[model samples]
Target: MEAHLLPCKISSDGMHVDVQAGFVREETDSISFSGHSVQKANFRGRPIFGTKLPIPPPYEAVLAHPTDSLGDKEPARLFVKSKVSSITLWNLSDEPKASDKIPSAMLWLKLAPLIHSDVTYSN
Candidate 1:
């Protein structure tokens, strides 16, 4: 399937970026916006609903590196052990204030032809 991007924007904090990631199904379209956060909260009960925890603002000067000084370039090479540790930090760390529902810009473009061109040429 061929997909087209509509339009998108970045948050002032840079923690969140919005975009039309991809499309699927019918003439109808799909879109998505993602936000970055340090913390998430959980309501402890049956059918629990929760809120994300609060995190410090993004600091451009100093921030977490995808890798560390020790040179573990492929730290994620240890996925099984790291997943839990990562989730724990995500749950407890402070996240961006969940506000500022900034709207993304949209671009209307004609969809590309989807049928197989070679099929029409075959004898």
Candidate 2:
């Protein structure tokens, strides 16, 4: 899959939109950063806080779409549009914490290798 750094944020909830014409508008200049460096933005009058997190080494986020079946004998296929090394996690109430679901999952991705490694510890 071709690698592409997507400038997108993952949200906890979903929205109903009819068209993609006015879904997103450029508000980068209005973006504010807190003392902790958490990026904040206003979307449709709602405040959202976000932080960019890496996808950990050797892993990437793939953006794909399922294609229609070619025939009954063939299995379904996915067309990978692009891949990203990092993604922004956005929260409606507050900044994303390690305790949050998505953040915790990402943390696990980084910790799983260490936890499963064959390394030995000595005092």
Candidate 3:
């Protein structure tokens, strides 16, 4: 899915650099920008939501690594986990300000294409 990326980082054994992260958002009947989770909130409770979290594309999409990540599961998953993971004091300067509505850039992430049996390593 396509997303506007907040200022963040991406690393791949030094093969890649200057990456940003953005939460996947979708226009939905349930929520709005900076919105609460759809499954957690009700229309009655928050009729004017901001960006609503999307259901992760598919089970396979959530599990498999992007082809660019060499289909390496942990690294790809870690890249994703970093989006929600808190930033360090060192990283805070690079992060998007909480007041910024639009992100610094956009990125496209492929849907996951693997299953548990396909993973060669695990945390």
Candidate 4:
């Protein structure tokens, strides 16, 4: 089976939409209007789960929504590392031009609440 990467923009706790990213999940074979079937997708070179991959050929980009409409309507809780440049968040509702400079207050509002009152969040 062929693997596909759908380009999408994701919002972080820091109130912005990030482009230049893609999503690769363990999806099934292409399903037609009449029928569908399941097949194994073995992506060569590297694993797509729990990691990031650069956008590939064919240039497929789907609007990325942070909401988990499949089961829970609540938005996801993302824990990001410090100084990750490749991932960008673009929240047009707040930040009109995400490519522009990010206001300090806006940046703090997005990232502050997600943090714990401790030294680090991970073990």
User: What TM-score fits each model?
Assistant: 0.14, 0.61, 0.18, 0.15
Badly placed stretches (over 4 Å) of model 4 are 1-95, 102-104, 119-123
Residue-by-residue lDDT tens digits, candidate 4, 1-123? 122232234346876543324322343444322132222222333332211222222333244335334456665744322322222222222212323333243444455655744575776
The C-alpha RMSD in Å for every predicted model, in order, reads 18.1, 7.1, 16.7, 19.4
lDDT tens readout by residue for model 2, 1-123? 323222355464447654336434232333323213566666567776676666767677888878998999997799987776556667774766778777678778888988999988999
Best by TM-score: 2
What tens-digit string does per-residue lDDT give for candidate 1 at 1-123?
111211223236646443323211121121212232222233232121112222222311112324334555645322122211111111112222223221111111111223323445556
Ranking by TM-score: 2, 3, 4, 1
Q: lDDT (CA) for every model shown? A: 0.23, 0.62, 0.29, 0.32
Candidate that would win on lDDT: 2
Model 3 over residues 6-117: C-alpha lDDT tens digits? 2235445847443333222233454322243222212223322233233333322222233344454644333342222211111122222224433111112122344323
Residue 104's lDDT in candidate 3: 19
- Candidate 3 displacement at residue 46 in angstroms: 29
Q: What does the lDDT come to for candidate 1? A: 0.23
User: How many residue pairs collide in each prediction?
Assistant: 6, 0, 7, 10
